[model samples]
Target: MILVTGATGQLGTAVIQHLLRKVPASQIAAFVRDDSKAANLLKQGVAIHVGHYDDTDSLDRAMKGIETVLLIAGTDEENRVHQHQNVVDAARKAGIHRIAYTSRALKDPTTLVNRLMEGHVHTEQYIKASGLSYTLFQNILYMEAIPQFVGGEAVFERGIHLAAGQGRVALALRSEMGEAIANALASPSEGNLTYQLTGRESYSFYDVAASLTKLSGKIVTYTPAEPATFIAQLMGRGLPQLLAQRITGFVTDIANGQEDIISPDLEELLGRKPTPLNEGLTLLYKL
Candidate 1:
């Protein structure tokens, strides 16, 4: 059986849904904190195991009949390293032959592309030394995050305002990433592998503005501000100073062209071209 951690969250839920389409519900198990939250999956005949990452015993017990585990990255950014380590240890102790991880697509796997990639980087190292065959999906930024970067309605109203200058990202949709991951899990593998999941091409914020203009028939613009100015503006909107600075740091990484690489792995796994930026933007903005 396959056990997927964080099965109630967005990415995990997507993974479970796609997995069910390929494999029987009996072959899939969901690791969730609240069984009630997973009522639908349980009703569909999927076994739900209630467990927390901090609880090693519970995690170990959840692995009883599981042959493979997908260690979906935890949301607790501060404690994720420790929590992920617990899951990895339990998977190793449970004698699972293979494991899969949702990692970030980095320009350099050995270095941090940004602060957010820290936990994934450390976890990847731990998994590699665990003597277990692994599949790491180094996913790029989700297209869904565009609305968050440049507001939803505000993007059309005030256009794009970011410190990320002309840096580009080959952003793919989360659902497609989940589909490719499910495809990988269903297929047999003999050795460890890492797939850099990204869209076919890169697009800058200016391109996003252009796409919006073309799709919505409304003129949009992109304003590339200095990192300090953007942080100050975010703080002026009432965000805390530290939070504002941290947000700026992410944009700063983008400005450095940290996410500009376009790889073929995503299309390879999907057996078709991933969604293009313009189409993704249209669906994202409902334009």
Candidate 2:
């Protein structure tokens, strides 16, 4: 059986939906923290396994009879490493042969976003040490984040921001990530393969702004801000100090163009180009 953790979440739900199309419901199990939150998945015939990353016993029980597992990284910034460690340890105890982990696009520890990804790196190291076959899906920024631009939630609000300005970001549709995850689960690849998953093209904040303006017929602008001011603004929005700082660091990295680059890896895996920014914008606008 294929087990998916965090099935109640956006990416997890999408993955489960894609998997249902290719595999029988009985062959799939969704590991959700709350059973009540998974009523729809249960009604769809998916086996509901109640568990949380912090509960090893629950994880062990849920992982029983499972062969392949998708470890969707938890969103909690603090204590995330420990949470993932709990899942990894339980998966090892359960003797699951293959594991796929969701990770960031780049693993460079020096980058600001890498601070957020440190847990992933540690978890990956543990997974490799456990001797289970593994696949790491290093996904790029989601196109869904673009909506935050219109509301000044992200980097576009301030007049200037710090980043590797010339760098590029290869964004991707979250749905395409689902397709890729399904493919990985259905057919486990030989050895440890890390796919730098992304959309078909790369774009700057200016490009993103142009796409948004075209789609919304509104004049949205990109204004970069210094890290301190950016963090202050995020804190003003009620974000915790540490998280706000991390977000500031990530946006700075993006502005510097550290994450800007497109790879055919996603298209090659899914056998089709990922949805572009304009198309994603149109879909979001219509919704």
Candidate 3:
């Protein structure tokens, strides 16, 4: 059986759905923190194993009879690494033969300026040293999150204003990444393997501006600003200081070319081209 942690979240849910198409529901198990939130998975006949990253006993219980574990990266930035370690230890103790982890796409994990990237790098190292058969999915920035990076409704109201400067991002949809994860789990292999899942092409904010203009038939433009200025703008809009800093860091990472990755692994897995930027944006924004 395959156990998926964080199964109630968006990426995890998508992965489970794709896995169901390839395997029977009885063969899939969801490791969720709350059973109440997993009503849909229960209705779909998936086994719900309640667990949390902080609770090793719960993780142990969740891993029972599971041969493969899909360790979805956690979101709590401050304690993410420790939480991921908890899962890793539990998976090792459970004697899981195969493990797949979701990590960010970075050319060099050690040199990245972003805190989120740093956490993922630490987790990846821990998993690699655990000696379990593993697949490292170095996922690129999701096109669906373009709205968050580019500013959801605010972009339409103002413009494509960001601190990203002239940086480009090779963004692919989360759904495609989910499908790839499911495919990886289907074929278990020995030794540690890494796949850089990215989009076919990279795009700058100017490209995003152009797409928005074409889709909305309006004269929208991208205005790059200093990181401090962008953070000030976000704060002025009533966003929390910590949140503003975190958001601006993504733009900083992009400007440093950390997110400008273009690879064929995603397309190879799907046996089709990964969704294009304009198409992803149109579908995401309904424009």
Best by lDDT: 1
Q: Judge candidate 2 against the unseen true structure and give its global Cα lDDT, from 0 to 1.
A: 0.79
Quote the lDDT for 151 in model 3.
75
Misplaced by over 4 Å in model 2 are 149-167, 236-240
Q: Candidate 3: list runs displaced more than 4 Å.
A: none
Q: Lowest summed lDDT over 10 consecutive residues: which window, candidate 1?
A: 108-117
Q: What ranges in model 1 sit over 4 Å off? A: 109-113
Q: What's model 1's lDDT at 65?
A: 87
Report residue 165 deviation for candidate 3 (angstroms). Answer: 0.9
Give lDDT tens digits, candidate 3, residues 200-283.
999999999999889888877899999999999999989999988988887788888888888889998888899998899889
Error of 2 at 168 (Å): 2.6
Screening candidate 3 with a backbone cut-off below 3 angstroms (N, C-alpha, C), the clashing residue pairs are none
How far off is model 2, as Cα RMSD? 2.7
Q: State the lDDT of candidate 1 residue by residue for 166-269, as single tens digits.
A: 98999999999999999899888769999999999999999999999999999899999998899999999999998898889777778788788899999998
Per-candidate TM vs. native?
0.97, 0.90, 0.97
lDDT of 1 at 96: 92
Candidate 2, 42: how far from true, in Å? Answer: 0.9
